[model samples]
Target: MSWNIFEKLKTVFMKVTQILVKLFKKTNKSTSLTPVSNVIATPTAHYEGVQTATIIAIPTNIAKAVVNCCLKNRIDLAEAIFRGFGYGNTKIVVTEKEIIAETSSGIVLLDPSKYRLSEL
Candidate 1:
């Protein structure tokens, strides 16, 4: 039994050695490995002191509409400044940046900047 086991192991060792030798020869015949490139890329445009500035513009269309509505109603612009506020809703607040309208359900915020004319 010992002789049979030793013979089996010796055959397996010889087969493994042959396979390793074949793989080593195949790899040895290949070319030397190298990098693809070493180029350091850079942008052509330079922004040294560039700063972002946002200018909030007035809504000319809304202003025009308000003026027309006041003209039609024959009321002063100061008195009819909030002519379009509070019908189905509760409190409505208008400012330079946004309009806050409070309803029975929730509060709505409308940005006046988005309503401005395209040229502005």
Candidate 2:
């Protein structure tokens, strides 16, 4: 038993910290086995208008406070009072019947005919 240089630098620093904690636990168990490997599974709702683009999860400041409370209660009564409160979630809720143009540069437009709620 004759080691010493501080036990050969503490056995090469415990075999380089056990090979860096087994390479960070095998890269966190291969990233928890592909938790949605590329993650793009949430599409399928495109009818464009009378509402149906819901993909909610909630929090883009509570979905822009439910799209500014359905754009202040009258864009078709806030598009029938915005409702897409989560069921799968990736954040989407487009109810477009918008058509409010008044653009010289003051910019106030929508689409489908027009919507100008006095250029909010």
Candidate 3:
């Protein structure tokens, strides 16, 4: 029926308008603080050493151990270790074979099997 069609159209329009409003709100908030180009440029350049990548699945227990090691030690120390591996500004990628950290200098790969999380 025409009435059902109208109701569906109305629902679709309202949903679209809501989505636009939310998007605009986010855009306005971001634009107000700094130029969009500057905001975009800084993080990418500063964190260039950090990159994200997918790899073979890592075991859950190994992932937990790495996290525990970082938590048990000061987070800063964990950062330092990553930096030593040459991943100073990069996001780490974990894999079955090793954990990879990127630095401005080059790639650092660490064996998960070798890593043992020390207790605090």
Candidate 4:
């Protein structure tokens, strides 16, 4: 009789422990799944007569979008549209202001003033 009671108590205890463990696991997963912000601030250096700083921090997706837009549209049209979209690419530069990229055409300024850098 006492043995039967002990078995029942043990089963209940094990089930409660499992439930607690599952709850803790779920809580941990939920915390880990929280989204992270994407904003980045890169150090800038000033120079005279055609700034020659290398842009190594532009996001890959933004660069791809600029390249794709340039490839898909005429230079003037792409420039107009991308400028409206807050970015543009040419033979020399991708985007303007802060100078995010450069090409064989020459050095181009990736201007952060044109658009929100955080969005990029």
Which model scores highest in lDDT? 3
Give all candidate RMSDs, comma-separated.
Answer: 37.2, 25.2, 19.3, 25.1
User: Is 1 or 4 the stronger prediction by TM-score?
Assistant: 1
- Which residue pairs of candidate 4 clash? 96-111, 97-110, 97-111, 98-110, 98-111, 98-112, 99-109, 99-110, 99-111, 100-110
What C-alpha lDDT values do all the predictions have?
Answer: 0.32, 0.32, 0.36, 0.35
lDDT of 1 by residue, 1-120 (tens): 234433343343334434544654788732221111222132111112321111112122223333333334444433322333322222223444443332222333345455444432
lDDT value, residue 22 of candidate 4: 65
Taking the tens digit of each residue's C-alpha lDDT, what string does model 2 give over 5-50?
A: 3233334333443454466577753331111212223243233433
Give the per-residue lDDT of model 3 (tens digit) for 54-106: 21222233243444444443343223223322112223444444454333334
Candidates in order, TM-scores: namely 0.25, 0.20, 0.27, 0.24
Clashes of each: 0, 8, 6, 10
Model 3 lowest lDDT segment of ten = 32-41
Residues 39-82, model 4: lDDT tens digits? 23334333333323343223334444344333334233223222
